[model samples]
Target: MSTAQLVSLTLAMLAGAVTLLGLVIVTGRALHRRRTRRDARLAADFRPLLLELTGGDDDIDEPLRRLAALDRRRWRAVEPSAISLLTKVSGHAHAALVSLFAQRGLARAALRDLDRFGAVRRATAAHVLGLMGHTEAAPALAGLLSDRSPEVRAVAARALGQIGAAEAADPLLASLAAGGGVPFHLVAQSLIRLGPGARPALAKALYHPEAAVRAVAAEVLGLTGAVETARVLIGVLAGDPSGEVRVRTARSLGRLGTPVCLEALIHATGPAHPHAVRVEAATALGDLGSPRAVPALCDLLGDPQYHVAHNAARSLARLGSGPAMAVLAETVAERPGTTAAGHAWEALAVLDLQAGQLRRPPTAPVS
Candidate 1:
């Protein structure tokens, strides 16, 4: 063929391909819309039954059996809603839903999906197992903490927490180390969810090599009310090399609120520690609510760091003791125009406002 004829033929083929692509796009969209409508209809039909199961305190066996017996396609349509409600319901409703999921073999399917090649599939499976509160799935979920996908790691962390697996605490803490692909907050919350059962692991984590892990462990120990671990936290506050870890340790020590932590918190508030550590230490003194922290907190009221001084004043207010109030009153009366005085005055005002609110009579209801 002549060169001009060849060029024309190529252009015609390109036009045909473009037309075919347009037709495919339209057909795909049409199919997608049809599928969506069908799913919505199925969800609507199933939602009331699901709601009846989850909302009532009455017999759930019928609803449970009906839901479990749904055909494959119908079950798939309602499964997402069921999973979404898992965390929202409680007591009999929750047990019924979990039973329904188990009866449908969802937990087993989800466990299998935990090893799926697709990250989204793995994450979704982790979520489903978590909402099901599947204890058996804990180990596999913990394994996903080091998954290549951050999202998968996060889902697994959350699932382990939902399952209340105390053993997963260590791996969750480990995930806080460099490149663990999980957020520190997620791990901490999960650890908190594990509750006091994970205290041993958390205390051990206080010694983890990674500072981030150590820091989160310290923070969680206090939040989880692990009073027995207060001494370990005190040591961390006094000697941990990581400033962030020391700061968290101080706060945790305060939350632990043992009188033994008082000296360590006081020591942390001294000039030897970083200002951040001192700030948290001062704040922790307030949380400790010990009269012994009064002197240390009062001294902090004059620290060069505004936050240190401000938190010191606030903590003294938190103490809510005669001596603690006297210190604030003295600071306000004698240290006028200083940073200490300003914070002290603010603290006093807050206290007075609280007092006034307490004394004020409740308004009578309208006739």
Candidate 2:
């Protein structure tokens, strides 16, 4: 071989070896830093709020209370800590700020940092920006909806919802259009956060052929109290392929607070309704707070599924707490104390009745 060829081969091998070694070293340092950083960040972030919850930080409580009251200046005081608190992988500081960032100003700052120069920065930035409603960043975030990375796209969608851009409703609604193709949970959440702006697109989604999208649309409509969609869903309740969609329709009907919705919920609780659908339907009946739902709800006490039994029993107690207290007492007698029993007690509590202790009954008498 020529001398130049020999020299070239040797140089290539050395460069390849150097690259491999450098990658290994970088990976090791990254893993090591990650482990220690989590605890250290929490220790630093909470150093200021240590006394707020305990009521021991008299000096800090007033300021903490002021912050809790949605003070933007309070965040400026803890800005770095606030950002760290939001980005910290886990711990009490993160938990403490979950509700705080729901306020506007800090949410905007997070949106601003979403384009920060790294993955971790982007992830945390995406979370806070999507949840806090940064209207100003809507266009920039919308551009990221098509990001090559799935994580980036997902977070961008989330941030768009937080920004509550009416413009984003069309995109998110389109994602749910085919139902099977898009991520349904993320679409549902974004639609929900889009709130009033999403009502039009969500109403259209209600008629989508995809059962999942229709079901989610019904759920969002109910949550947002979209009374206008009631008539449209009623038409769908008759023959929609999925029982879940029909069940969601029943629940949304109940949310509309029309007396007609009670009948729809009653009809939906039949054997035709899936077990999970029946639970939501029954719960919707309770939210309706009508005397009419009591009998059907009472019948659900014997449902084979425990969740349905619980929801039905609770609904009956709500309508009958004053006159139906005996009925609820009887349900607890037959089934024993459970979540339904808890709701029954709470219903009684609302009726000005005292429930000092929950009672446990003897097992059924043997034949």
lDDT of each: 0.87, 0.67
Model 2 ranges off by over 4 Å: 1-140, 179-183, 254-256, 302-307, 329-356, 362-367
Misplaced by over 4 Å in model 1 are 352-367
User: For candidate 1, which ten residues in a row score worst on lDDT?
Assistant: 357-366
Q: Model 1, range 1-367, lDDT digits (tens) per residue?
A: 9999999999999999999999999999999999889988998999999998888757877788899899999998998888888878888888889989889998899999988999999999999989888999998999999999989998999989989988888888888888687988899889999988898888888888899989898899888778888777878887889999998888888888789898888888888879899888889889999998888888888888999999999998988869999999888778777778788888877877888843232233355
TM-score, prediction 2: 0.60
TM-score of 1: 0.92
344 in model 1: Cα distance from truth in Å? Answer: 1.6
**Cα RMSDs of all predictions?**
6.2, 9.6
Can you give the TM-score per candidate against the true fold? 0.92, 0.60
Residue pairs in candidate 1 whose N, alpha carbon or C atoms collide under 3 angstroms:
none
**Mind giving the per-residue lDDT tens digits that candidate 2 earns over 251-331?**
787778877677777877887767767788888888888887777876776677778877776677657545456767765
